[model samples]
Target: MQEIKLTDVRYRPKYHIAAKSGWLNDPNGLVYFKGYYHVFFQHYPYDAVWGPMHWGHVRSKDLIHWETLPIALAPDQEDGCFSGSAIEYDGKLFLIYTAHYNLKEDGSKSYQEQNLAVSEDGINFTKYQGNPVIKPPLANNTENFRDPKIWSDGQDFYCIIGGQTLDNRGQVLLYKSHDIYHWTFEKVLATSKVSTVQGTMWECPDYFEINGQKVLVVSPQGIEPDGEFYQNHHENGYFVGQEKEGNFIYPQNSFRELDRGHDFYAAQTLLAPDGRRILIAWLDMWEQKYHEQADGWAGMLSFPREITIEDGAVRMRPIRELGKIRRETLLNESTAQGQYTFSSPCVEVQFKAMQDLAFEFTRGFEKLSISYQNGKFLLEKTGYKQRKITWKMETLDVQILSDASSIEIFIENGPVISERFYGEGDLELKFQSTKDVAVKTYRLEL
Candidate 1:
């Protein structure tokens, strides 16, 4: 048998973070320690599919170029080291995660408990001697508790763990820790207990504040499809409101989907020192087929996006640091309206359209048709269904970043739609519109 190299994987992304050879999922334990940005993910190294989990490590001085590190946590006395978050305490990096243990009673079901690991050098880590710091509370009877997202307020650490209620409703459990070892359950922060809400299990819950508004992002399972929303098997969305006495005020009226894309879930966000709430998510949805598993790897992370609240809704756009990845200018002009072809999968395109226009990007059979007609913005791909979005604004300005097998479109600094495509050889992009659109294209070095 022969081992597969990364260069042979045609669908592997160039700028996105991916496991070198196996499966990668939910962006986990995202934090900035010392000087570099560390991104840990849910990884299974044995195969290109999900299995006994381990935390795969990678660090980047800049978010564009990444260097792989050793596997951070392996299943020592548990079935897996599931999703969690990281923080820097006393000049040492600490990881708080859910350790899943299978009970030999009938060898059927497993329970979840919160555990801790510490590292001084950020490269080597050891499980804390006092393991299973927090077990499942008596109120919640299910075994679906996991994904602890932690943050601090100058002194004590606050964490949120996704769980299910006794009635099977999706719930977010809040906890407080003084030293990252001892934890006390605070209360249920939020729940999908409404008659209209249908989510059963909440996974990868992220809580943060942006522009004075508190935001809650969660990947909820069993949300039925509603029009163009919740079409995926599971959905990741957020609720924007103000926190009043440990409760969320629904200023936006209801929960809204964060990204209207086919391959986004289990997203996590961390507040940078520079006062930016940046986010990254699992770029492949579980409902979608992973065509690249045959090539020896399965998933990749979405490009880091900055989250903001505007007009009473949560908006996301690519970080400005992504401009550093531009190596050469390919197209730049107000009237730059022609068909451009490229051989590489890494490219960045910026363009503004007025009234009616369409940008058709084709790589063999996979076509990404982006168009704006009569105040309506649309994104269509070959395999997935189209997404039509409408805003109060008249003009549409789009910035697109493309990697080996995925594309992310940012519209007017707000709505971002991401999708996946598989093809070989060259990529062709054709611009056609009723109005002369200003366009700029660059080739990314990463």
Candidate 2:
């Protein structure tokens, strides 16, 4: 290996495409426009850390091969382009983002206003003449207003804006538009005061229908710990509900956390042209430790998932097509009702660890769980403090869930946790350790 120097922040010498030189967070606008997948993100191109935000671009006929384009947006047009949503209207792709105009001296207190942009070629976007289409509500109760997630319902366009109250409570504001522009205030669907010290402000709000049920996804910031709620970034997940005439009725008293791992957050969904509900999440935990930020790019999006309801919870895992990238089968086998072991990353396997070994397995580590039977204990690691996070992570992601093709875990070998990092092979599942040990491995051949 040779030491490479000076350029922009990039994802090593491999093929993982990142936007520009700086920080890239939530996937802003992800839609299958025309026949290609147009994925936009929240990017900051000048540095490795977060600063002025812009909308980055990438398009792929197939999700695997991506072509990076010029920055779709920059603070040059606005002070700070906060996160928002994008949609296609009348054969044109339109973006609705939060333009944060900070006026500390003017005493406006850094408020966010919604702005619009239109793109005909799906590449170059033009700002709307009537910029800042909608200003923040005049109500004295709101604060930190931003993140407009707009979607279409029949012929009408509906949007949900994330915001906070003067008292620091999180709320999502709803609006209705008969014609893309001229949005009318609908109502405040829900209000959640996350914690004692932390004020909750909704980040990104999304509404969709799943299996005859309505689901509401939200990103809430400034949250305090209250048992299950406010877990990751105060939490980014959805609720399965019923909506009639625009009002949502969530009989379920709580929200579900999409990914149990430390990496996935700020998830946004899209109904692909085929009508399948697919989702993508920001695979970077907010304020997380054990991160290798020095590697330049800090965040990556989760593998696409097919969202579904299971036992009143929103269950998400990698979509089936994602596994097609499995160029070679490194390991493959079925164990004869037995106990097994796999405490590593580079290696792969295709057999269960057994009831006793799996800790009473129910589908082998679905996002987040704790089930270890007999002697084989399985824990899905979500990063902890002090000692190497890999030690704990190996107990779950590697030790338990590595048997499936729905996951593609990126590894940085460490001599400290040799049990998890085998080598840099990018190997596929080769053999299955039934009553014995069988494994396979693979690498993303760019």
How many steric overlaps are in each model, in order? 0, 31
Candidate 1 residue pairs in backbone clash = none
State how far residue 300 of model 2 sits from its true place (Å).
1.6
Candidate 1 lDDT by residue in tens digits, 2-95: 3234436788888899999888999899999988899999988877888889999999887878989999998989889999999999999999
> RMSD per prediction, one decimal?
2.1, 7.4
- Candidate 1 residues lying further than 4 Å off, grouped into runs, are 1-7, 103-108, 195-198, 251-253
Candidate 2 yields a Cα-based lDDT of 0.60
Model 1, residue 218: displacement in angstroms? 0.6
User: Which 10 residues in a row give candidate 2 its minimum summed lDDT?
Assistant: 413-422
Model 1 TM-score is 0.95
Model 2: per-residue Cα lDDT over 121-225, one tens digit each? 889998888987878998944647888988997789988888787777777788889999889889987666343333367677888877787788877666555
Q: Quick one: best lDDT, which candidate?
A: 1
Which segments of model 2 are wrong by more than 4 Å? 1-17, 193-199, 226-233, 289-295, 334-351, 358-371, 374-443
